[model samples]
Target: MAAPLSPIVALVRAADPDRFLATLFAPAAQREALFALTGFNHELARAREAASNPMAALIRLQWWRDAVEEARDGRPPRRHEVAEPLHAAIRAGLLDAADLLAMADAREAETAEEGIPSAGAFTAYLRGTAGGWSVAAGRALGVRGEALALLQRLGAAYGLGGVLRGVGRLAARGRCLLPADALAGAGLSMEAVIADPRAAAPLMRAMAEEGAARLAEARAEARRMLPRSAIAAALPAVLAAGDLRRAGDPLVVPGPRGLAARASVIMAGLRGRV
Candidate 1:
């Protein structure tokens, strides 16, 4: 068997299986860096869940911010699995600290207990986290130009599908990310949805519509450009397509980590498309 590149793969495989599966198609030399990016993102996401309050969450986020800076400055990274590989990727010039830092900055919004305020706010979050991360991966893979932009947009669409997939889990923890306007139109509120998943039905439908539309638009645009180098970064679009189409309720779910998801990815991979 081939030797492992980094332990970050195990974490990425568990925390963000979709990205991990997608990474399999990346060049062997580039796989470690791709997982490092997703591993870093996974750790940043855990910071919110691991903290007790907003101040605590901010502190957790700050630790990552500091680690990125330390790595960029050539200083030793604070000891951590994800941080170590991320630091290496940064130093090796396979990844950019700027993009990693931007992802961390955007995650600061998770500190909000009131949930997302509007549709625009949701889009901004998607752009920063998912869009930012995919751009970082594409850059690491040497993807550039319109293909890069296409990758970023596709990432945002995947982010939306991800949010929908996690609605039940988030609500069970007293969080609701469905945009407030969409909630109002659905005659629901964040607190209500957070307390009762059923109330989110209409809002979920609206989000599903928006997510599906974005996926369609991204698919159309992708047909025009996405280069072979970007397929790994853009693979989440395949997951988003499957998830959005079969999405039921946030309180319920699809097995994106199961065989079905892998099959979808394999089919897309075989087509050399995302």
Candidate 2:
């Protein structure tokens, strides 16, 4: 029988993921758990957009939704391939199955939608997936109430940053995420902006700058309110998302320079030397 994937192995399968997680977390145990969580997230993300056929991708996403549900109810998973590692992370981190299910729900909704209409809808969609996921991770690390809220806020910032960065690739998928109203006000349409990649650059710069500012605020809050021990606990989650600001575009596969920078930042935090 083939060996189950170690956390590093699964995480390292994707460049950004490996760099981000490896740099931010170093406790062999926590790293393993995080690797499992991020690996599953990356899988779900790809299943939604990687394949040529949208119908097939939708089916695959549905299968994931079902697996999340089954795992939540303590039923043996229907899809072992994705379920096993995810289950391991849940156990290791005290992760709630509900948050994972919520992620699937967000993807299911996005897959069915024709396209994002405005920034509000995009924010709502991100809240369900990225925001939910970060809150869950914070909870796993034992953050509560206010701290949890802050984490969710940071996650939202990360999601918005990703959308801006990935505008080019996202437009290629027959979906556009820029707030149509916002773009209209800016005298742009999703099509026009994407068609002329340079046209989108200004908005992308604005979004990235805004996201970085929000993240900086969140990090400051964490440093103040969170216990020192837990600061390290929170560091990786924030830094992994923060690195996106420097990763060029979220949707385009990150290159070696971006990946290497991500790894360095995380490793510094992991060593308690950042």
Candidate 3:
């Protein structure tokens, strides 16, 4: 039998299964670094729920920021599941500290009470978090030059699909990441979106349309330039098409995950096309 999963890997599998599956297709040696990067993202992603107040949340993020710097400086890492392996990867030169730090920096914006201010701001958030994560993973996989840049754009497109898909769940948590202008155009506030998901349908549809266009552009570009070495890094985009399609309908409940999701991932992996 295969070795049992590591704690960090298990955590990622449960929290971000899509990325977890994508990571599995990586070269065995690089999978650990990918998981460490993803696990770090998962930890940062939960900062809001991990702390009782905004200050505490910021402190938590700062703790991560310090951890990244420590990793880059060749110092002992704070003893945590994700931090340990993440620092190990950094020490091995399999990951870049700058890309990891960019992921953390973008998340600090999530602590704000107000939703995203504009479409441009929303895109920037996607660029930093998703784009940074992708390029970091791509670099770790031996991708460089224009391919690394393509990974960043593809990651942003994937993020757009994800943001649209999770709008309903986010609204339930009293958090809305929709562009303020879109919300205003729909006459909806974060509170309003939470109260009436249907009221936010128009905004969701608009976001879906945007995601489709971005994904199309990214996919065409990827076909021309994304390196095959970065297949694992880019594989997460395989699900973006289905996500964008469903995103326009907020009331549509997501079906359970089963064989189909895995099968699609497998096909994408074999084809080296995300």
lDDT of 3 by residue, 1-274 (tens): 9999898899889988888989988899999999999999888888976888778989999999999899999999889989999999999999999988889888876777776788788888888877878899999999989888788888887788777777777777777788887788788777887787778887788787878888888888887787676798888777777777778766566665568767887898888886
Clashes of 1: 0
Ranking by TM-score: 3, 1, 2
Q: Flag regions of model 3 displaced more than 4 Å.
A: 251-256
| lDDT per residue as tens, model 2, 27-142 | 45455545545555666777767766667778877777776666666766454544676676665546677777777667654565445677677677777666665666666556
Residue 48 in model 1: lDDT = 81
Candidate 3 weakest ten by summed lDDT: 249-258
- TM-score per candidate, in order? 0.94, 0.78, 0.94
* Per-residue lDDT value at 93 in model 2: 47
Candidate 2 Cα outliers beyond 4 Å, as residue runs: 1-8, 11-30, 51-55, 91-93, 172-174, 227-253, 257-260, 271-274
Colliding residue pairs in candidate 2: 23-266, 23-267, 24-266
Q: Tens-digit lDDT track for model 1 on 1-274?
A: 9986457988898888888988888888888999999999898888889988888989988999999999999998778888899999999999999989999998877888777788898888888888888989999989888877788888988888888888889888888777788788778898888888877876677677878887888878776687776678888888888777756577785564778778988777667686
Better of 1 and 2 by lDDT: 1
Any residue pairs clashing in model 1, and if so which? none
